[model samples]
Target: MELTYLRTFREVAKWGSFTKAAETLGYAQSSITTQIQKLEEAYGAVLLERYGRKMVLTMAGEALLQYANYICRLHDESKEVVAKQSKGTLSIGTIETLASFYLPAYLQAYRKAYPDVNVAIQPGNEPFIIDAVKEGALDIGIILDPPFSDPELDCSILREEPLVIIVSPDHPLAGQGEIGVEDLENESLILTEDGCTYRAMLLKVLKSNQVTFKLSYEFGSLEAIKQCVTYGLGIALLPRIAVTEEVMAGKLAAIPFIHPECKFYTQLICAKKKWKSKAYVGFLELLSGGAREGDSDAGSELSK
Candidate 1:
């Protein structure tokens, strides 16, 4: 089987649309179809079945996807290993929240320690960054929270961030110190988009309590949400780090959640089976301080 065919198949499988796969790979739609067709022919099995305009993977396609991912990872790993010996670069992906709040100091230290190593930092939202890492477009990523579960990826907790409620100083619940979920009834709420892990958690809590609030707005950008809150648009539930400056400057008041202080772990995530390089190990050590916890080293010394 041609590796190019497998690559095309993987791209199609990832996007679930031939058009999208073609666009992403810079190939024509017919070329994507022909590649998948050739792959199916070589395997002597149907890989994908079309439903309306979208495509769903057959069992064979699903099985092939696993192998394709492994092959792609191996290919990248080999390239990275060679690059490491020849002055290669490291690609790191991170969400906007971490990029704005925590990554600067860590990156500064990393640069000072390894000035010879080339580093590229890609900043995006959580979902985009996670997808990039999984697809081998990024070597590693730091996200505000981990996904539900992925056997192919290893996730290590970097820190825990408390979720706080932000409101105008004069809002009724602003001076209450800590407020329960029940206290938020009838308040205007601003939230992040649905895919955000913390947003999902907050929605789950609200639904479970049968509480109702006026959802004033939902935003995709963290900065936009902060700006909205600064103008007293509505109360916002946000990671403590995201609102620290605003809260400190008296532009917003942060109150802890009384019932269950919304908290989520920030984590460093990477492909599980990829070969670890000295640079990767060194970076992990710097982050974890040399302790391996739960199959992940907070600091390095653990053998693969």
Candidate 2:
């Protein structure tokens, strides 16, 4: 009967971990367990069963999930109507690369324009970001090109650029006007985490070109990757947008990596069924419209 119980059940079922669901919902682990117990008590049926490290839903739980989804969606839509007309909170998910170097200006401008609508952001990798958007946990998402298509989502390409190889100004590769994929063989590389889309593509290209490589470091943060490359720790391949400021500052040099398969794109994605609050619409307008009014200087710098 309680919508809170259904929301907690949905999260726990999706993640299959009480601890993870608790952290995401800002509840204690015990609270999640208690909510689940309450749901089972109210339904008069066994719902969740544990099998080793995994949680498996019983038949009754599976049947209830269908109704729970409908209930939660209606619950959200009802709240949307009761909140200030056309105003509510919007949560956006993105990768660290964009958050740290790219979206700060646009987000700040959005806050100024929509004072009544609170905006928040959560960061994760590409796939995680997309999954959050699909589940309605996030209202919008910015991510790399999704690996596949789904009818439940809508997405658009916001920007596209060549993937570039970057290194310290004094590094040997920095002098080359452009580097072939083979030239990177045996080079120490700094890259994002192992499963990142760009990192995986880079390694695949190297493998196809018969280049053996070693990872000097693997980082989850773009800033850390830049710091390592700035000191000659290792070279990296990243989207030009992520490293433009450092490249301009002469802290690092960006060179075209000539491979037929190397390209990067930033995509804006949203669930087809998500409620579009005025805040969400206004923020997208500012972001896709061009740099904000006062961002002329920053925009001009990045245009190079």
Candidate 1: regions farther than 4 A off: 1-86, 146-149, 259-261, 290-304
Residue-pair clashes per prediction, in order, are 5, 0
- Which residue pairs clash within candidate 1? 288-298, 290-299, 291-298, 291-299, 292-297
RMSD of each: 19.8, 18.5
Off by over 4 Å in 2: 1-87, 146-148, 291-304
Model 2: per-residue Cα lDDT over 172-205, one tens digit each: 8999989889889889999898658888888888
**lDDT tens digits, residue span 1-304, model 1:** 7788989998898889999999999999999999999999999999999998889999999999999999988988878766654356778898667777766656666676677778788977677877888888888888876333577788888777677888887777788878788888888889987767777877778889999988999997888898888788988888787787888888889998755526677788888766777777777777665323532232123322
The weakest ten consecutive residues by lDDT in model 2 span 291-300
- Using TM-score as the measure, the top candidate is 2
Clashes of 1: 5
> What Cα-based lDDT does every candidate model obtain?
0.79, 0.81
- Report clash pairs, candidate 2: none
Q: What is the lDDT of residue 105 in candidate 2?
A: 69
